[model samples]
Target: MKLAAQRLIAVALAVGLVSCTDDPPPAPKPTGLNAGTGCPEFAGSGRQIEFGGEIDAELGGVVLGAGSTGVVLAHMAGGDVCQWLPYGQQLADRGYRVLAFDFAGSGVSRGHGVPLGRQVEAAAGALRADGASRIVLAGGSMGGAAVLAAAPTLSPAPVAVVALSPPTGYQDADAAAAAPKITVPVLYGAGELETSFAESARQMYAATPSTTQRQLVLVPTSAHGVNLLNPETGSVELRDRVTQFLDSYAPPA
Candidate 1:
């Protein structure tokens, strides 16, 4: 009987340890932006901000507009916050607060080694800290996979997600595995001519369980990732469709 009791206690301790390790680390405090040099010139009246992680890496970010519904824009691999600036400003003009941030080792952000999904989660916390009551995550390429993986586990969960040209997996984030677990509305888009990314979009959309809230859109061009939204190089129809989707599932007001 004593041996059985000891085994049970050991099992209980093991379970407790697993649970503690599974819980996400607490959100980091904002550390100010660009070391007080102010936001980039293109930010245009946006406020500069920063958030840190366990390794003391500080991510650079820009915030625009004012509202309870905030939109967090994550950029592509090798890209920075500038990649999302134009679209983010548009979302801000529509009454949604917007946050465009640089992941660790990208752009003005410092530090390395943090997982992509964790960086995304930290960005969401930064938006909430900036006074947003709700969140909508949007990303391009590698950023798209990161948001998809993070969405399933984010505290408070995002109200919606927009993924463009995302791969099934990018580094540490796996959108394919995360898709089935996402319960919120999601807009998946890619260029039809960009075969692999387009196929990934389709697979993820098909895998998502929310039949009524998931959408897949493929444009005619070969543009990939954020280029699909570029004013001069992208598809007008795709841009219009995204606007419509946001209005339907995540109205700014």
Candidate 2:
């Protein structure tokens, strides 16, 4: 009887150890603003969306607000949709339907060599499908160059464009070539201390045809790209200038 009891006890211990080993580890805690394959839920009214290019790559995006004028915001290189969420929320609050997206190879998006300008085109189409009648394009750094390059080709063209710290060219996007073709109102902004970008902005402005209503704004601060829109680190004059330009050109409906 004692031998039988000991055998039962050993078997029970072995079963308990197996069960403990089989138990799964607790899920890892969320690490950043983006939790998974969807838009960050912290973006207030922003909703997760997806747009695609000719390749299998599907770009992840977020769209918010309900306005007739649509604004497509492109992020700087190495940055993602999260970079624009704060500013996008502000635009949404002001009655502009804003779509901020991750370009291929960034954020939740996929793909390797897709042209950034084409990605912007896809984003604009997504915004139009979401109910925006008028489109305004905005981008920072690499994104700025992309929007400028894409502006001249967009169907119906953008009513206005805001390029902050745009380069003459980025990957497949060529703002230099596209500038001469842009006939709509264009606002080119950059930090006076970022000499290269400031110079590029000037050159693009010069290349823009005289028929276009073009404006060049150089702020005293050294902030670059979308940093120009940051309420904390960005410039007040630059922000005000952008607001004035948007109001004058694409007034929210």
Q: In candidate 2, which residue pairs clash?
A: none
Most lDDT-accurate candidate: 2
Q: What TM-score goes with each of the models? A: 0.83, 0.83
Question: Candidate 2: TM-score?
Answer: 0.83
Provide the global lDDT of candidate 1 against the true structure. Answer: 0.88
Q: List ranges where model 1 is wrong by over 4 Å.
A: 1-41, 54-56, 210-212
**Over the stretch 165-201, how does candidate 2's per-residue lDDT look in tens digits?**
9999998999999999999999999999999999999
lDDT of each: 0.88, 0.89
Expressed as tens digits, the lDDT of each residue in 103-144 for candidate 1 is 888888887688888888888898899899999999999999
lDDT of 2: 0.89
